[model samples]
Target: MAKKKATAKAADNLTFLKTPTGINGLDEITLGGFPKGRPTLICGAAGCGKTLFSLEFLVKGVEEFNEPGVFIAFEEKADELALNVTSLGFDLKKLQDEKKLRIDYIHIDKSEIEETGEYDLQGLFIRLGYAIDSIGAKRVVLDTIENLFSGLTNEGILRAELRRLFQFLKDKGVTAIITGESGEKTLTRQGLEEYVSDCVILLDHRVVNQISTRRLRIIKYRGSLHGTNEYPFLIDEDGISVLPVTSLKLDKPVSAEIINSGIPSLDKMFPTGGFYKGSSILTSGTAGTGKTSIAVSFADAACKRGEKCLYFAFEESPAQIIRNMKSIDLNLQKHVDKGLLKFYASRPTMYGLEMHLVAIHKAIQKFKPNVVVLDPITNLITIGSFSEVKSMLVRMIDFLQENQITVMFTALTLSTVINDQTDDGVSSLVDSWLCIKDIEMNGERNRGLYVMKARGMQHSNQIREFVITNKGLSLVDVYLGPDGILTGSARETQMLMEETGQVLHRNALGRKDREVLRKRKLLEAKIESLKTEFESAEEELNKIYIEDEIKRGVLNKTRQQMTDLRSGNKDI
Candidate 1:
């Protein structure tokens, strides 16, 4: 008895089991997925993707989890539902034929049921239970609850029936999704549906400035924690993909790895020799400052390293960018041909900001690129305000960094307040900020590139002369001449003048050395002549002295003995 009690207590204490929906990024925000063996409410207005959401949950169960699902439609028949989902690449017919999926259409006459005062889901339970048992299904979806109870206006019967339906699904041990229309103030048309469901998700579709955006928010999760932010979702040829905004945390792993900035000279400006891996780089500049060139160069560098790069072009087509970069000696077509580079070009007006973000998120997930570039993000301003754009970018950067994907955005700066605000707002969120501006000097405008900020690394403080030539983008040190800092023709002129002065000074020094050499030779010749004359004089004096000594000796000998001295002298 004690063992039985302990076992029962353990089962009660165990966390609720969750069934993964298998939709990209949906399970992340749902914090595992919908509750297993319980119904989840997916409420939204018409065309807000409630049905698609439920269908995806069912299809993904079979596809990813090996769990068959039964989709019960109250509005559309099985054939209609199948045809509707065909475009999303869902092979519903094949799944049905293979017994992996089952579809049932529920029909009701609202007028007749109301006249008869008969409204109950007892028959629904029998039918749904049989379907679940037939395929041994683990997932179920009710395309809509509004049509199921359209004949009933009494709140008490609706509440009881809704509760009963939820309990029936729970008894069957199958996870279920129930769709509903949006109410005026509440999340669903049946105001109390959110209160009973284990999980309640709200979908919203709104148009601002004529651009439509679809967002999803979790209103309530009875026994689990979930993201509360309105995550943007995308519906394209692939199906539904939700971009979880608040799912990423600040503690995501970081890398000390370095990646090149495409330009060798520019990389030299950073102490790390390149940008940090997974870092966000913002290149902001005015018109004609070669911002796109910097982005393209970065992409090329990544592709050259045998890594994939995704380029999102807002102002130019892939062909246009490739053609223009060729002038600078960068061959981007090879990377594209090698499948290392992919380009997605679209105008900012193509969709709302959130849609753009979802599209980018989808592309990144599909391509799994190591590098991403958004050329001229300034074009996004046409669709949304600065704050909205900034918010979208923050979400995007957080997502990218969480995945350890390096991203670079190029922003066009102008003298007006709009461009300034855009750059200022975005620059703060980036890991590195490279500002390129025109430096008007020497009757010509030259580009000056400088690093405004680079987190976690040392960078150059001096503004470098940014030049675009046949060899691609390069940075050169600004010339320090008599005229402060100089670039372009002024720098060249100062260098030329300094070189000329150095040549003249060398020539003058050489002339002085030659003159000194000539003077030393002349002085040596004069000294030698004087020494020869002195030696001659000394020899003559010595000869005279010897003669005097001999004469004195002869006189003394003559005085002593004339004959004897003369004989001695003759003998000497």
Candidate 2:
């Protein structure tokens, strides 16, 4: 009975302790790293960053937590391991000099070993135990346990020895990381290693469209809560950082701060001046409907207010965007020069969806922008399937909202009309949706803009006509004239025709009045000239009559004289 009580007491004291994973965003996903004083299995195919993860854990423990660590490499030499991690900012040589870190490389050569009938891994344990005790290490890493399988041909002995090695590490009370290569069918090549470990994490490296992405997922963790989602991780100079996306919950209270949408008219449409600071806005439209222009305008407005903004251009280069905006008079170069805006342009197929998320997260953390804009999120579909891209976007939007960052994502909707409720639709997940489309009106296609939905705020329901001109984008209020809401170039033509008709009518009436007045004046002048000519002709006729009368008198006088001379001759 005394011995039973002692056993119970020992079991009670064996409460599972938790270890902190030095990687940012990882501890949150696993509740708190791994089970302390227990060996955890990290299995992955070659070049999946399993060794880098283990190194990060050890380096973080020593640097941040002030806990000493022991690293046992079964495959790589000490100098080789040190060189591999130098880019991650880990100085193994420096840590070794401080006596706080210990690195042991077990050089195993199958040719040098004699084929014994039976063998135990106790000798390896003795060396690891000595190193752990010597530095009082709280963290330990055994990289690539599958290397032992290559050296040992006895499967029965390898399995038993692997179990015993894990048990020995648990007995030593050190948090250990044991990495193994993935098997063809099982979680690990040596399947027994996963069962003996307290937790199992799987890493995957895949190339899609010639772009590589590293993904991490927690397969199982005994006696602790863990995130079930596969997260995207990145390897850079600072080591591996996994982007944990499971913490998106809307239960938290929202802020009442009214943030401008960069568009004054758009803000006026919202009751709260604009969207809530952390609200997500989705701008979806057909091709050539001006989604990127709208997103850029939003970013410009944010930068104009002195709020930092980040623009991720997936479809267009920075120079191309700047040149395009020049036509609309939106100068982005000045904002970039002022450091109020940052532009990151890359091809959508440059990396997988997860890598894109990691890059955005890292940029956000570094720039701490108040607003983030992704110009055409649909471009990411090239790397992932529709469902995968949607899932990734949901997580990304959730992450942005948690940090109170206003994110605007532009997507190209293939359909002529997009409904708020539908499969593979982003409208349902977004806090606000602004839809732009081409509407057939008056024998021509015209751009139409509307607010499909804006939660927790009052917005305009009217469909506004959008025009792009040299000055920039303008929203024309719907005309309430006899011809309801004139649209397209036809409306402008009608307006011009009406204006030209009124001017022509006025000119025609003016010309008629002038003609009437000029005709009256000419008639009066002609009558005066004819009256003077008639009076002169009568005077000349009277004068000629007088002269004719005078000539006739003379002729009569001559005739009478001739008659008298003839009469005298007759009488003689």
Candidate 3:
């Protein structure tokens, strides 16, 4: 399966004959690199990092790709370039000593060289050829080819010779990178000299809102499809790193494993009992809404799970974060000591957005954490525009998800009214979004947390009261009464009042029940008394009738003597 996948990838990439540049993130954007054995023109303004880019390309070619390189510097000496790049950890002298690289500084002076007759750059060609043959170099870099215009007086001859040089390099079958100074109207300061190359990459250094940013764009690439979007780049201790803002696809593998949010109540809010592994979580809230506290809880939980975590604190120093977490009963220092937690603290203004991103990328590559926490990503908005910040976040989230690393980000919403939204515009890209804010009701403000959205899980829609104590953050049920939701001291007062009312209601119901029972018993006794009186009256009547019969019989006997034939006697 692995081999089949590899074959498929190869087939996808077979459209272009590319030579990998070995620069982080650049090769991916270019689909592989510059077209093989083709000259690519790199033009940019002064101090825009054109030189460093070409040098790194050649160096990487030698060290990584096993392609020997020849550097012909027409601007600076070999020693100067080497000294400038030493900090980037490139051992130029060592590479040269091993015959894997060669640096030839070509000095030109208008006063020293005169174009007295029609002449081609045959001597220059011989020199470059010798350097290439000596080291069997497969890569060549011509630093600022425009120097020929100053050295030679004839414009026609110089242009023709320059074209010949490009043709010669192509004939040599070596991938070459030619550096040029940027012009205001053209891709290079030398009007039409860059047209000879098949690919042209332009670098720019721009400052906006007092912050500096570097960008790269490809003007043209012949016979190959390339990305035309302007990519942000950064130059730091490592070297030039281009951050491509595109290629955020949804095809990355997702995991079914769930990771806890550290707070049991908060975890219970989600149907999965936790967040999905490799998912992006955005915690957005207003000030003092426990965004950082929530992020720290996640870090603590990850460390306790025996997983490594990276904490990026843009708003606070490491000491401040550690001390603040301690107050919440989160002892992050222990995790740091145990090598399970790493903290990278820097003010968001310390560098441009691209530099910060590059630093983060390098850290992740080096540390290989299972979880990453960005405490308060909203602070980055001060350095970049909203769209730029969103793009950077999208790229970061994409990278982490591709690696199956769960990431958490905290954002601050300045206004209480916008509590349901995110400030940096990255909320839509996250898999789970938890929004927290102050619920000001009954003349008091209390923290409230709710899951604004949790994709692929049935999350609670009720807003929970945020409670942070010495034991960390927790969610309590909000006070839902006739007056609507209440929190903080107001909720406490409402709860107390509700308890009192419930007690009184129970007492009243008990009294009413007892009264009803008493009335029922009284009615039963009255009916029984009536039944006894009726039975006694019937018995008296029966006795009277019996006595009457006896009297009548005696009377009838006496009357029969007088009237001889009383029917009564016969009847007797």
Candidate 4:
């Protein structure tokens, strides 16, 4: 019976151990959420998204987790809070009417309220407790706890009551989130972090190059492992979205299926006839080097394969991109019309890097594309620092690759060399890098394409001439001649010159063959003449011998006539 009781106690403790904040990536960073039944202090200066973070925690607990929540607002009123969050599509009023939530605004103005000596916050405690019990709340949020100190004159009472309030919430077994203003030297204004010390999260808002970025950092989380790095978060229409800037575990499954790169010539470059599915492809080049052309080709190819594609253009409008792609015969508008392609055009300066990331996230969730393309990612550098851009891109790449989405990014380089490329510095992070360069020859520039890296795949090493004709984009072998690698008119001129040389060489070989045949004929005639002459000489010699024989016979016949004994003639 004692063992059974101890087991039950352990189970109960485990049940109320941690609560998920329901913020997008916050729960993952916290390793679960804030400690259950303990107060977590969220401190920041004005407009750092502190209140929104806490409100979201409570609202999500009620809506998503089905846990009733109590919101004791010390700054904004119930109506104002609801009105403020309506834009975020959080129907706070509806949640309250459904009895799943309770919002009580406790306004404490320093000028309106006069604090008497030796007074405790028993009234505040009663209100909070009644609110909690009325809804059977499991989550509580005290937004801007520093406001409570504004109406207090005695620091001793304020500090003591603050500690007691936290303890009371803990005693009630309700997970609480306390918001406070950031202090100059401390984590929270009025040192509220010193009291409600279970976990402390600090929010920071900084401006760089006239653009604002919000960051969230966990100052301390006692008795738990949490992400300590500063994560860039955004407070947009969707509420707080914190991007965990840690290197994600490289456990995402790699795909073996090869996807065509759209251009047949380009596809032939890869040994697999295409790129690996869910791999990141980077096409970087200088001005007018066909970076966008290559990206559009990829998107067109994906769409032609009946896969959805999302194109994020930072420097061009949708119409502009569509129009420009038409010159290359990509026909991006047709894909968009068929709903296989989606274009999202926006300026990089329109929002901070985090907000842009959030927007992209939202778009991805909505579109659920199989492929994503970002044209001219270098424009993003104008709005953010190099490291910031790299971090956001890393998070995005990790997310996309994990979801098995093939991503293509186009970066514009200021120069031709790879080392002096764009500051985005995503070259090493990508799976395949296709570098486009301007091949200047014969006082003209032509585009050349080469694969700098393709992880886990064999690709072509030779630079091919990239041509953008009205028919489509094509890659041809760059002409290598006596001078060097040739392109443009030089390549064509050299090609013609080589053809002419081949014709001349063929003619010379034909002439030599004819000359050899003629010499053989002449030599055969001379040998035939010598044989005829020798035969005539032999015939003449035979005739002369016959004549001599006849003459000797006649003489012998005369002698035989004289002496009839012809035996001598027979012997002769």
TM-score of predicted structure 4 = 0.83
Clash list (residue pairs), candidate 2? none
Tens digit of per-residue lDDT, candidate 2, span 442-461: 67878888888998888999
Error of 4 at 101 (Å): 1.9
Estimate the lDDT of model 1.
Answer: 0.87
Clashing pairs in 1: none
lDDT of candidate model 2 versus the reference: 0.84
The whole-model lDDT of each prediction reads 0.87, 0.84, 0.87, 0.87
Looking at candidate 2, the ten consecutive residues that score lowest on lDDT are 417-426
Please provide, for model 1 over 304-415, each residue's C-alpha lDDT reduced to its tens digit, 9 standing for 90 to 100. Answer: 9999999999999999999999999999999999999999998999899999999998999889999999998889989998888888888888888988999999998877
Tens digits of lDDT, candidate 4, 1-572: 45954674587666646789999889879988998778998999998888788889988998789989999888899999999999887999999999999999988767887766578889999999999999889899998777776777787887899889999998887899999898889877698888888899999998877888788999898888889988878776877787775555989988899999899999999879999999999998888888888899999999999999999999889999899888877788889999999999999998888878877887887799999999878889898878978988988898899889999999888866667344377877899999898877678989999998999999999999999999999999998889888999998998999899999999999999999989988888888888898888888998888888998899888877767654554543
Q: In model 2, which regions exceed 4 Å deviation?
A: 1-15, 116-122, 153-160, 206-213, 417-424, 440-445, 480-484, 497-572
TM-score for each model: 0.84, 0.79, 0.81, 0.83
Q: List the candidates ranked by TM-score, beginning with the highest.
A: 1, 4, 3, 2
lDDT of 3 by residue, 233-293 (tens): 8787887777766664789998999999889899989878999999999998888889999
In model 1, where do residues sit more than 4 Å from their true spots? 1-13, 109-121, 149-162, 192-195, 416-422, 503-572
